[model samples]
Target chain A: MAGRATPWLIGLTLVLMAAGLVGGLWLAPPDYQMGDGFRIIYIHVPSALLSMVVFAVMAVASAVGLIWRIRMAHAVTAAAAPIGAAFTFIALVTGALWGKPMWGTYWVWDARLTSELILLFLYFGYLALVHAFPDRRTGDQAGAILAIVGAVDLPIIHFSVQWWTTLHQGATLKLSGTPMPVSMLWPLLVMMLAFLCYFAWLLMVRLRAEILRREYRARWVEKI
Target chain B: MDSWHEFWTMGGYARFVWPAYGVAFVVLLGSGWAAHRGLRRALARVASRVRGGRR
Candidate 1:
């Protein structure tokens, strides 16, 4: 791995993330109803979206590792557990905050909220399984299998609100709708992009660390 | 309440709104710090092992 490439990738992510945060937090318009507090949506929506994206990435990486015996893939899947868990935490927190104002309660047992809670549990379960085995390789393989099995629950998480009775609001920033005012939309989009960049940047750093740990005997690990 | 409008503005809801934000801020900072620390520890362990392997 070229030393230059990693730095460049990280640098690009930082630049994109900064631009996105500024656009979302400062430039975007407050919601007509929620006012200034609606700004949390920038953080909230991205976290929700990334929670799904990160898990999907982990599952796919684990599959690759199992099928092709690519240790790099296993490392990637293992590295993502905590990051995805963090995103899920953000989503749940922001949701509760927003709900306090809008729904008149700090927490609710609605279908959407419950399902999101389950997603967080799933992430924790995968992490726990990884550490359960006495052998590290056994842990990795077991965790990978768990990731694949857990992926089946993702679709349920996504559609739970639509199918069941829930207090959570439906999606607002769809591609087809007349977009929210430019003020609001700009900031939301910027925040979403910022979060995506941040996720990628963090994932790469974690994966690199995992690579080093697993291949510590190799010359590359020594140089790093 | 000063006025109904002010109350809806969370002049009264300040307790709820501020705590939500506070909780979120704490969670974000804590997680980021944890991840950074974990990675650093992993790197250090790897570096140590590499040195031992060389010996």
Candidate 2:
């Protein structure tokens, strides 16, 4: 399905990411409250958002694979697991870096933070389970179940700031209204789009390889 | 030059700011490269099968 569009997607992602870097690191002005430290929001928000989005993708694909017994669906779940883990790790690390100066600690038991951490662990567990079984089908089924269950944490993580008095800040650019000035907001939005595209590029490339791997023994594998 | 210096300094939050961005850079680039490598490995196997026949 991804075919030749993969290269073009990668190129576009690179361009968008570079533009995001410039917009974030240079064009966007410093925060009045957090000062330059708040620039971390550019990376933090995008990676954080992407982590959840990746998990949602993995969970949905896992469910489809389990329900319909689709080989390609399982392949998608397998390919997305590690990438989702990577994104989650990025989010946690960047969040910690941003936290130290603002919150007086690198980590805390805040609802948002803890839930996001659990999300990372869920990704890890899913990846481990997928490869654990000697029989690949059993492994995929087990991982899919776990992914579906863990997806309950996504909304918990998202709403934690509102539900609890966490060290993490509430949404800065809500659909209702943004507290941010145009300069800061635009870069953050660009960075988020860039990261989303980055995930898309990664997923397409990975799924291609995954599909090939899963179908390697099939007769159709030779023709492609 | 002064404003540029201020920008880099992150208004004195440079320590946190730079590391945050730096780690992000390493992770994103590394993951993308890894995915590309995996794709190559998968494709290379396909090409190899044509020459040597399936294992």
lDDT of each: 0.77, 0.86
**Model 1: per-residue Cα lDDT over A122-212, one tens digit each:** 8999999988988889999999998998888788777777888778877757667845787677666766776776677677767777777
Q: i-RMS values of the candidates, in order?
A: 4.3, 1.7
Kindly report the fnat of each predicted structure, to 2 decimals.
Answer: 0.40, 0.78
Write model 2 residue lDDT over A1-224, tens digit each, in one string. 57677778777778887887788788887676787788888899988888999889888988898888887888888898888888889899999999999988999999999999999999989988988999999999999899999999999999999998977889767899998888888888888888888888889888888877777666677787
TM-score to native of every candidate shown? 0.84, 0.95
Best by TM-score: 2
DockQ of each: 0.32, 0.70
lDDT of 2 by residue, B1-55 (tens): 1377887787878999898888988998999899989988988887777667744
